[model samples]
Target: MIIDCIDKYELYQGLGDGVSKALEFLVSHDLEALSIGKHEIDGQCVYALVSEYETKPADSSFFERHELYVDVQYVVRGEESIGYAPLQDQVVVKPYHEEHDYALHSGNASFVNLCGGMFAIFFPGDLHMPGISDVPGSVRKIVVKVKA
Candidate 1:
């Protein structure tokens, strides 16, 4: 998984022309005003989702595998703790479901706190768990999905 600091996004422009454009759009836009839906910009698919307390905790099973479209998890407001574990480290607590494309694993996972402007990227094999609560309160975050 690539954990890019917002400032270093420019360096990755050559990686994928579309990804560069997607990152540019995310960096330039005001996340708070957006709705949860798909937005087409510069011929790229930008799926925007504004999440509040109503959103459920991310299913670890889902993130264990799958080539992700870049997962730009930005916290527009408040703090959130996200869980993570490497694929190689995973011990299957539950077998994968072909229909759902996920499986539950056994182990103590790691977590990271995402605040305003802070984000994380999860590629295939990088299992991530998001939407966790902080001690102070809940968080409002926006996840922009871009094809990787």
Candidate 2:
């Protein structure tokens, strides 16, 4: 997990070639106007965030592991807790769904608190539970989906 301002995204460029491009695209685009659609870049799949709704605890416990995409979740406003667990440590709670491109894993996942100006990257092997509320209020977040 990495938490930093959007302007500091350049420091994370070398983390991976595909991730770098995704970050660059996110930095250059107007997140507020982008539609929630899937777009391909450099043979990689990317999902833009157009808007956000209220997040709750029930929405937080659904951990998913994607086979073809890495989730680059950026927090534009508010704070939320994201549940996570290492891939190797997960016990399959349910079978993977090929159509949805993800699986459900079982375990006591850890939480990463994400506030505005922060972000987290979850690879294919990482199980993540997003949309968790920090307080009783709602949190608004922008999720940038990148091909794994």
Candidate 3:
């Protein structure tokens, strides 16, 4: 897992070609103008999903993990709290779904405030609960999926 502002994206380039490409796409494009849907950057290897919605209460957020992809979640607008926890010792709330590449886990996590221009990278062993806030508020976020 990695948390940093988009201005420092270059520092994470050594992660891998896919991650580098994903971060580059985030910084090179006008993400705010993007439609609320899937945007292909490098076909299936690197693609981003733009979404806008009201934040959910922390207790209602579920920790999710993806196996085949590393998520580069960038906040294009607004701010919210994101929960993070290691994969170990968590009980599976929902079994893994291969087609979706995710599974839900129930565990305690520490929260981080992610405002606009900030991003979080979640790898396979990182369980993350996003779209969380003390008070529900609108947010526009982009989640770039990089093939792992």
| Highest-lDDT candidate | 3
Model 3 misplaced regions, further than 4 Å: none
Of 1 and 3, which scores higher on TM-score? 3
lDDT of 3 by residue, 43-102 (tens): 999999999999999787689989999999999999999999998989999999989999
List, residue by residue over 1-148, the lDDT tens digit for candidate 2.
5656777889999878777877887687666565555555565466655446666774446678888877788876777778887788677877788777789886777887877777788878788888776455555566667766
For each candidate in turn, the TM-score is 0.70, 0.80, 0.98
**Top TM-score model:** 3
Considering only N, C-alpha and C atoms within 3 Å, which residue pairs clash in candidate 2?
none
> Which digits, one per residue and each the tens of the lDDT, describe model 1 over residues 1-148?
5665666778767756666666787789877777765566644455666666633444432334444355667776777777777877667666767553446665556777777667676654567767765344657776666665
Least accurate 10 contiguous residues by lDDT in model 1 = 54-63
Better of 2 and 3 by TM-score: 3
How does residue 48 of candidate 3 score in lDDT?
Answer: 96
